[model samples]
Target: MSLSRTLTRRQTLLAGLASGVMLARPRIASAAPTEFVMGVNGGAAYRNLYNNVLRHFEARHNAKVVPVFGSGSELLNRVLAERSRPTMDCFVTFQGAWLVGKAEGVLEKVDYNKIPHIDDVHDFLKDPDGYAPFVNFGAWGIVYNKDTVRTPPRSFKALWDRAYDRKVMLGGVYHWQIHLAAFAYAWTGDQKNIDVAFDKVKELAPRLAGLYGLSSDTQSKFQQGIADIAPWYSYTAQRVRQLGVPVAFQMPEEGGFLYPSAYHAVKGTQKVELVEKLIGTFYDPELQPGLAREDGFIPSNKKTVLPAAVAAELPTMEEVQRCHHWDWALINRDEGAWLNRWNAEVRRLVRG
Candidate 1:
């Protein structure tokens, strides 16, 4: 099945499950409640964390959460389509998509008064204008099998080495922009110019074992020893390691990419109070560490203390300082033109 069809099927299945839960509950005397539909990433790791939060919110507020899962872009499209009569009460997406939602005026400005927990979040993680506030973040860096690569790679340049030919796996086209930005900075000391990055990627194409569109594909490659190294978010790397895959994560010496997962209230949502409660629950210091532990995310709640092991696995403050934060607004604006250039120039040059 096509990816879209597969995602639609998954969403249907999950929605059915949510419906079942609602039906199973016995009706009791209480005020009429609202059903808050949240759009979130359709990945197992993300669902695990969100589900936990959902359970707690449901119990406390007596409201049902109907989760709609899809890719960030896909969810954004849904929000736009439903702008006349929005269905999604809130959206959980990455920084780039959040910017797009803000630019499109599909997101509601967050009101801090409703979510007192907002004060506990580190200032860096808070959206200055409060359109989308980051709940958790993870660093993007290199993942490698320790058994295969005795010498750990400390830089993005390692992916270009001829010695690892046909042993490297890269993220698919959609994710290449981040890699391109990293390469642009590493090669030309300019993150905005992609010319250098494109040339470098074309050079490394012959060495690539494969390009993965999903986390499962990347994990399978590592499991089968078909790939020795790849680029991925720290949460994924941590999950793979937990599965005893002989994998290790390294923040490249040049630095890494900081990818923040944020939440936005849909512009026309009627459950503003409920949405605030959900967002508050997501960033609650009591729940933040557990959510972070589920996926190795760095909690944006400054007061949430992580376990020693979880803390060790995350990017240190110094490492975070070295990481690159893209001009997402600019990238989102030019994404189409960039994708066109990539397909016509870089992708066509790939070997096999």
Candidate 2:
């Protein structure tokens, strides 16, 4: 419980207060279908959210799901900014962002019994605290242009090589978690020591091509040959290649971090049971593996059985162990300062 980071974001809340007041209605008088907005990551993965997850839930519940998509960080800002009355009933976003939302007091816990399929989740991925229900995961590592570099990057450390000068696209300010994990792993062998990580970032500053905030932006950079490499997630790498970009992913020998995708209810949302149930739809054993085949991420459900082709392609969870797993509470406490340091010391030095 760090002091709430969202208390000062009242300006954003004020701006939306009038609209929320006008639209916030009691579901008392009717049995009409409920309409709720879901905030999620934008870009290629929208396919899985729509085709595999959303539509089915909507059909069964007679509800209308409107999706508001953005990068995980952007969605986090929205959750905190609208703390008193969130416009999005629930957000399907990343673990670190969810940690911040929970700390900021904008997130609501799901009653485990309410989400039926939650029991199907692997014990290792379940959140004992109940705020973030991580449904999918992917490997975060280096992705390189296969056409230009015949030698696939074998280590995260390769990003700093002089040969990659002005040819690397790193995550933007919003993606502070990955940038920290990357630089720390590159220099200090783990993500816990920020002092060492900051030093590594300053050293790599000279070689950066630019910073990107979205999957679409990353794909365009690789496709147009604007950058030949980036520290990115495997699911994003797979989506980029599917769009005709020639790239390949590798979990460096030191290991890569896990990108866990989670969904949590907004504190003031009127549709509590509905929101949790919708999230539960993603856990259906038959639908969970589609996260692997279609969205390019590993499923979190213990009962999910991936097809042979997908099983062969994805890296084993064991491959992601070199770095220390991130702890949610500590991350919430330190994330803001990390972003501030990145902007002041690292972002200012790099040129696109």
Candidate 3:
């Protein structure tokens, strides 16, 4: 890792932190309800967390827990569209998306009093004003076929290196690459770094074997020997390797960003306390090990121990902290325009 590069990114994050953007919470929370609904994104990690840990919470509290699964973007939009008459009490979201929703005033503030586990949560999970809180922390890494990636790309830049020509795959129509471009630019002090990153993407695009919108698609491609590498969350990378595909995951010396999926209480719901309990239960220390082991996300609660498996799958916390933090405020302010630019300029260049 380049110390100079790492320092530059930290400086940018510090500048954003100094801006004092007030912590924004969801717009409303309903009164306590007997039965509550939760929005979830599918697959094993989500299923284990919801079906196993969450079911335990329900049994203990003697309340009903309904799980509504969908794509991350779809579920978040559902919450926003139903803001006036919230159909779901709480929705799970990736930190990046959750931060965007919080800025848009779609999430409700959590009541810590009803849920004491707030105290166990790390400082990063708790907004200064106590609005959004993390349920789990996730990281992004590369997955490579052992036979194909004899010397896997060590950094994001490797994806663009001509050496891996026609052997690499990148996620498209998603925020992973977008955030990565932003991080790369922020680290290099390149105001136009996002575009630069996109240029790199275009350079490597022609050599790309495939583009995946789903984790399963990426995994299948690797298994079938169609493509050797894919950008994915650490959990997915871990699971893929376990399938005996001779896969290895990397956090890259450039460092990957930290993202946490959090519980957002929808405002104007009749399940405020129930929602709080649901959020709080995720922070329980006893539950963290199980979550980290089965789900592959770091429990947001500081008291939660990071299982060896989960820790092995992701970069060290210090390494994660080293990566450029995506200033959500800035991203929120410009993501639409940036995304539009990406679609028109970046994607067009790739297609050509």
In candidate 3, the residue pairs with backbone N, CA or C atoms under 3 Å apart (3 or more residues apart, or in different chains) clash, namely 26-107, 26-108, 27-107, 28-267, 28-268, 29-267, 29-268, 30-269, 30-270, 31-270
Q: Any residue pairs clashing in model 1, and if so which? A: none
lDDT of 1 by residue, 73-136 (tens): 7898999999989989887778888887888899998777888588887677777786656777
- Residue lDDT tens for model 3, 184-211: 5634754346666656565666778766
**How much is the lDDT of residue 258 in candidate 1?**
89
Q: Comparing candidate 2 with candidate 3, which one achieves the higher lDDT?
A: 2
TM-scores of the models, in the order given: 0.86, 0.82, 0.81
Judged by TM-score, which candidate is best?
1
Q: Model 2 over residues 1-352: C-alpha lDDT tens digits?
A: 5446655568668858856765675443345778978888766688767888888888888799888987777888988888876799888767777767777788888777888678777665677887757877888888889998777668878777788888888888556666776667567765678788788878888678888767787888888888888888888877676677888888888777777878778888888888778868888888876777767777777688888987766766577445345555556678778888888998888878
Compare candidates 1 and 3 on TM-score and give the better one: 1
Query: Between candidates 1 and 3, which one is better according to lDDT?
Result: 1
Model 2: weakest 10-residue lDDT segment is: 22-31
Candidate with more favorable, higher TM-score: 2 or 3: 2
Cα-based lDDT at residue 322, candidate 2: 52
Whole-model Cα lDDT of every candidate shown, in order: 0.79, 0.77, 0.69
